[model samples]
Target: MFFLKYLPTQSLILNYQEHFPDGAEPKIASRLEMLREASLLLRDLEDFFRAHDFSLTRFLICVILDRADEQGGLQHSEIVERIDVSSPVISRSLKSLIDERFVCVESETEGRRTKRNRLTDAGKARLQSLMPGYYEILLK
Candidate 1:
């Protein structure tokens, strides 16, 4: 069970509680409220990325690629682990990025069979463009 020291979301809690059975636990109701709030925030963030013509996953890949060393790139497994996403999700995002000229596969191999990835100049620029607004939101 998740516990918060202070829950300042009274209206949200009330709304969520109304849908549950009469004797539902307060903890469950509050958890639902928190989940609802998180979902809304995530949706807004996704919409912001979409407005810039990029999905959230693709934007994240650009960030990861941009942070790699000048002469090194991230391997497919590295990206999957760092992003905490499934293989197919990372694969699709990488494919979209490659098609958009935002990312590329480096010829250099990490090990026996690992293919490395790096961001193109276009990807760096795109990330830079979004950074100001992103930072503003975070700072607030």
Candidate 2:
């Protein structure tokens, strides 16, 4: 989301006419409007997730796991790759989800230290519950 909730007014954009070449003004105005609308959309998504006791990150994780092999879910490193976030943050969130009984991990091999993360039945249910609200937020 945009750090500045208060975007510049149209008059302020108009004032930039003197600084730019002739036709560039309209392009600049269009870009600003796009950014402003995108920012508002992101904020709405954030709020909707928060109200449902969920986080976007967690929801993304669930979505990824939903497509993984049923017998074994995605590896931690795989999730990190898919989400493009720091491993520590993924680990922390995974830990929380495990504690909440929303997720489980299985050792990949007898002696291997690696584990795969999978959503428990409860986790799947929770994700299912959130989908409708999430869709409404977008379509509305």
Candidate 3:
């Protein structure tokens, strides 16, 4: 006895019930539609990132660093865990960011080696430059 208040057409609902047989679960269908929409949004974001010569991972790292705690920054291991990327991939991205002067790293030896990363002024600017376009795409 599920009901959809905003169904496009009665005929569409009838067709859906026919296809589904037992009953038409509009909520499940709506959830699936939402997932599809999210996938499309991600695709758009990826395309935008590619056109800007920035990989999504790199952009995400900059964002993470930008929002990191004020105490200092996140360690390499913490970043790896947060992003769910392999150490090698994270290392390569960090190296590229460092080369581009978008990020800085500091190493410490508090019992064990720790490398902390934070965004540079340039990184913040880069992210800021992209935000307008990102927001426009999302709004559309």
Candidate 4:
């Protein structure tokens, strides 16, 4: 019983091959299949991130912050371009991180409506803690 529950995901993936015919499955896989791969891989990371009080948006914001340009922050517009997420989507994410003291926002010089965002020390620390597990799955 314990063995049944302990099977690794990699093992299950290997076994899924039996359901398909020989040389029939796309070796390179399609875009939809790639999306499926992303979905499955994210499941493990999502559980880990959730333990750290992160949603996918929050986790993605951390990634954005980590890759920010000159100001150690990115403009809201820039973040949307890089992540392909909507402004409202990132707005909610920024709010959560801000409330948690994991990030800060600065009004743009040009206008109050525009804002730049950066990760806080706490956010970086949390990201550091979560990195190893994230890296392990991503590298697989």
Q: Which stretches of candidate 4 lie over 4 Å from their true place?
A: 1-36, 108-113
Question: How much is the lDDT of residue 127 in candidate 2?
Answer: 85
Off by over 4 Å in 1: 1-33, 109-113
lDDT of 1 by residue, 1-140 (tens): 23344555656666767676865657776666777666655666677788888877888888888888574879888899889789999999999999988888876735555578999888888889988866665454
**Candidate 2 backbone collisions, by pair:** none
Error of 4 at 29 (Å): 5.9
Error of 1 at 25 (Å): 6.8
Model 4 steric clash pairs: none
TM-score of each: 0.70, 0.80, 0.74, 0.67
Query: Where does model 3 exceed 4 Å of error?
Result: 1-24, 109-112
Please give, for residues 1-140, the per-residue lDDT of candidate 3 as tens digits. 13233535545555667567565566656765666677777788889989998977898898888889374778888889889789999899988999999999876556556778989899899989888878987998
Alpha carbon lDDT of residue 84, candidate 2? 76
Worst-scoring 10-residue span by lDDT in model 3: 1-10
The Cα error of candidate 4 at residue 98, in Å, is 0.8
Candidate 2, residues 12-124, lDDT tens digits: the string is 87787898887886788788778877777778888988998778888888888887857589898899999977999888878888898888898899989988888999999
Task: Give the per-residue Cα lDDT of candidate 3 at 105.
Answer: 80
The model with the greater TM-score, 1 or 2, is 2
Candidate 2, residue 24: how far the Cα is off, in Å: 4.3
